[model samples]
Target: MVLPPLRRLLRTAAWLLLFAALGALGLLLVRAFEARGKPDLMPWHRIVLAQELSADTLDARSTWADVLAREQQVFDDLHAQLAAAAVPGEFRYERGSRIGARAGERDGNRSFESMPAEPRGGVLLLHGLTDSPYSMHALATIYERAGFAVIAPRLPGHGTVPAALLDVRWQDWSAVVRIAMRELRARVGADAPIHIVGYSTGGALALDYALDALDDARLPAPQQVVLVSPMIGLRPFASLSRWLPLYGRFDYFEKSNWIDILPEFNPYKYNSFPANGALQSYLLTARLRGRIATRAAGGNLARLPPLLAFQSVLDSTVSSADVVHALFDRLPANGSELVLVDVNRASLLAPMLRSAAAGQIDVLRGTKPRAYRLDIIGNLRADTLDVGEQRYDPGSRVPVERPLRLAFPSDVYSLSHVALPFPCDDPLYGTTPRADEDYGIRLGTLVLRGERGALQVSAEQLQRLTCNPFFTYLEERVDAVLR
Candidate 1:
């Protein structure tokens, strides 16, 4: 009887061991399957959607030049498709409107009068880093119609050549603003309440001016300030450089890779400067914030002006929250207001918070202690921002679905980063009416439309539209407040 019982126990132990081995094998298989299913190694063509073909056209063609000329031809076709889908009459150019000026032109002063005057206060439009004043032409036209004199000045090393940007420092760009500010003051008088509007890095510079030099005896503080998608901090990708020593040593190490990454959106790839240029921008922003903090600590809040900032939560390019937090921390108590504009409120991602459990979506969290009233606006397009992760399938041999979201909040405002210098209805592309007259209007309305169907324009919008672009939402809010 003892021998039989022992034999059964031995068989049970053997069976248990076999089950454990099978379980381990299954786990290995699952991990291997997941690895094979990874999105890595997928063809670049298959990674991006058909729509990205146009946005990536310039980069794809230029970068793949080493591969074959056929690649360039393919991207060229994609570019044509993008142009066709773009808003009608949006990209046309006006007659006799020169884009870039040759150096040492004697007729430079003669053409000053070419820009039309408006009824509102004068506007000083500044472009972002690696960009020119040409980006502000379209928005500038809108300001002109709204009755404001617009001056879209090209920053140092920009609009001339890309190589010039290599040697250009942050101060050099700031100097250009100083000159433009002086000119605007001369044109509109010291107390005419000049409004300063900046895009991207330009917006950061504008904020710096407000913090550092606005109250200087040499130039009057701007009557109002507007920042669109300001670059206040290094993007998430920059975080990696902190860990890699090689990334810190070679400033230009990532330049080549970054240039090739997004060609169509960043046409200035050929003109990329040393990586130090980016470092300089980073340093300048840091210094600006430090200076503001120092001043606030010393109780010197009188120098800062009432400021308004507009940032798109879906922007893949800049940290919208960083800009707001930096400004919010430095601003005098109740001196500034923050506006968080949701450009993706209408897409599949419209109710973004609901999808958070899926690990594909997130909200902009304000780092500062203060709570900002968030105003979500649905964009004219599908309203979804392509975070890129959900659509990127590395294992798939075929192309992924294209991400369809506006590039920036201003893009919804009928202004491209490069076209803010000209009028909204400028004849550059043609005098034809755009099919979507309500493009920005819808966005503007959504911004004011609040819970319980109440429409109250936030304080930030009031400051932005004071001397520049006029939003009907702002007008209605002001009227209601007055009543």
Candidate 2:
């Protein structure tokens, strides 16, 4: 007997899906084999730091002192492991080296706290994934000088070794956030306001914490939320990262565990990224999307504190549109604001930019009315390098333009996701690194000219904007809020 047309169509569709899945799997396997040619795995990549808190051991009731003691143990253990391996002097894990993770009194790799003689309030600074508390150190100092006690915690699976990222879960990071908040609250008391400044992955955690606070009164809610290049969503293909690392299936595919196993040259941040790190970030974003939708649907978001977020119009790692549509769009009209840094329209390289990159600001500022204030930092005129702000208040299409003292550097074309939190005078990733401060390498100021594919680092990595030229303006805006 002949099958019905509907049944035949369903059968054909299933077979097509199966073929697509197999094709994708085959491509992944081919890529896995290609990854074998990468640089040999060092001790930092293969040796997972044993002292970093596992998900099962992390406790919400843990105090700030407890966290620091645990971190010290982690460092001690890391040093012991590396000393035994006798890692090369050039490596970051080499003990007593200037570029090593534990170099000075104020080691950026470790969690730290700063307080004034008498604190007015407290602020918790959260760094991004694969980043140490060092990323937040500058901002933390700024906040502390502004009279707020600052606590910057080293999240689990970071600031130790790249191998630590392989075993980390998103929940472990979230637990650290809760514990840090508890200590921050205790320091400032219930009466003084609490605030959070989260960069990249930390931005997602900040938002997640606020959403949780809405439902649970036991958690202290932040008075204000500030985000810098937040990870609202990533590329769709990132979800497939979970399955790419099948190293356990065969010893031959050990290198497949890592997405990019680069030299650990950056003192504070891990250069090597594991497949599991991407998987955890994807899982966190997935959970965040669900929580955001649920809170918005239940009309519970209005209870959340006002949010101020900074986003670059052109970012390769995270989706900029999702920052607006996913989180900002769902936010209540409680004085939330989004500051978008547009590409340097007046740069000489304007002719080289893709049409999509040039028109990204216009696309982000779509026709729909927004509940939050939208500010675009861009060229004041098509011919001028001087920058200005075009402020669009809630529910308004027309903007009030104000001239800013800032001007885009002639050579710089745009800001990057990692550039927002750093100043032009930063020691590590700055255009004009400070004479007094040094991190052994100045990544932001390097200018190299050579044939493509001649260097271990890609041309794209070298060319990507590493420091924010307008960081002074960013600092002023943040100070205004905290003060």
Candidate 3:
């Protein structure tokens, strides 16, 4: 029934679409060839090898001292392996050049370090994926100053080469956490209260462990739980991340990964992330949610401790909405709280905010009594840059506002998922460190003024804010909880 001219136009458009799909697939195939042949970048460098790192075994759990010793031994192996495999002058794998230790000392960040003294209580700090004890160093210092003996373990598959994460599963991370908790309890005794602080992927582990403890009396229970940008849930695409490995099955696409591999420039965090890491994190979160439902059905949720969660409104990593619905909303009225850091409304970037971030504070407390408190740290007014706390008390619909001393940095639009743990003056990530104990690289003060693509790392990396302007408030809130 269609006219000849209209039918001819439709057929031509279909042909164009088919050609475009073929062109995209052809480009991917060409990319695989390019990646596999690059000398500075290789599959082995990115691939996970099975030599059984300390993070892969339960035998490392003798004592804190023994666990640290084993971790160092594993690092030694990684160093040797990297040295042997690295191409000359390649900064990614080179141990003592631009990317790693400068003073010939083993990377202090790769090993476990504690700020232990006469302690009032015990606090265990768990870092995120591809991060080490270094991520928690600033927070550990805060806990140390507050008379809390802090134990920040270098999670297995971290604090070493990027390839270390390839072979590691979620169980390995949970195992190390159990060992760390046992050591903390042994040091501080059973009667004294113990608190657990987790960031990103570590947050999932903390919630999972706490849920297990509720069911099992043998596992140690945290008196309180604090999460920073917790990974309670991820994007739906993460569930299918396991299929990513199938791409490597073909010879032409052997080097192809879920994400394009990059150089490792950052000392504390691995600049190169693996597909397996994402898959494990997704599986762990799935298990965590399933367990939460199981516990809720039995009316055993009352055993959960108070949870203080700090989430960014415009997070690209974890779901900010899930922080409210899946985790905090399910709590049984045990004085839990959710602190959301709103995007900078006063900045030029304010209009660029996604709809989710613009209405981030409206997570459903209207005309209803919620079990927990909701505190939003954001602008005092839409017209002003001044920041304050909008506190919604438990069971109250109306929020009480309190102005604070802090204000948003004019240039920074919003806090990132990783920025929550670091302060403005942190040695590596800070713009200015409160004290100068160097890790050889002071990335926080970097302000490069040059042509585009001049730096070795990406512009996207440089643009993301590394330090938190409101860190003093974070410290005060945490200190109050400790007291």
* Candidate 1 structure quality by residue, lDDT tens digits, 1-483: 569889999999999999997876665444444433322221121122222112122331232122124323434544354444443221111122223223363211110212345234567788776665544544454456555666775554444323344445677667656666666666665555677878778887887887656456656578667666676775655433222222322433323222111111122111233344465567667787687777778878665665656554544456655665556545664434444444333344344434532221234533224422323332334533322112212222232333323233332322222222222232222122243332111112223333552423333332221111223322232222112
170-250: candidate 2 lDDT, tens digit per residue: 998898899899988988888999999899999999999988888799898999999999988998978988988864357
| Model 3 Cα lDDT, one tens digit per residue, 406-463 | 9998888889888999998876788776554665567777777788967657777777
10 residues in a row with least lDDT, candidate 1: 260-269
TM-score of 3: 0.86
**Which order, best to worst by TM-score?**
2, 3, 1
User: In terms of TM-score, which candidate is stronger, 2 or 3?
Assistant: 2
Model 3 bad stretches (over 4 Å): 1-56, 59-62, 86-92, 101-108, 111-117, 249-252, 363-367, 433-435, 438-440, 448-458
Clashing pairs in 2: none
Which segments of candidate 1 are over 4 A away from where they belong? 1-120, 236-274, 333-335, 343-346, 349-374, 378-483
lDDT, candidates in the order shown: 0.45, 0.87, 0.77
* Top candidate by lDDT: 2
Superior candidate under TM-score, 1 versus 3: 3
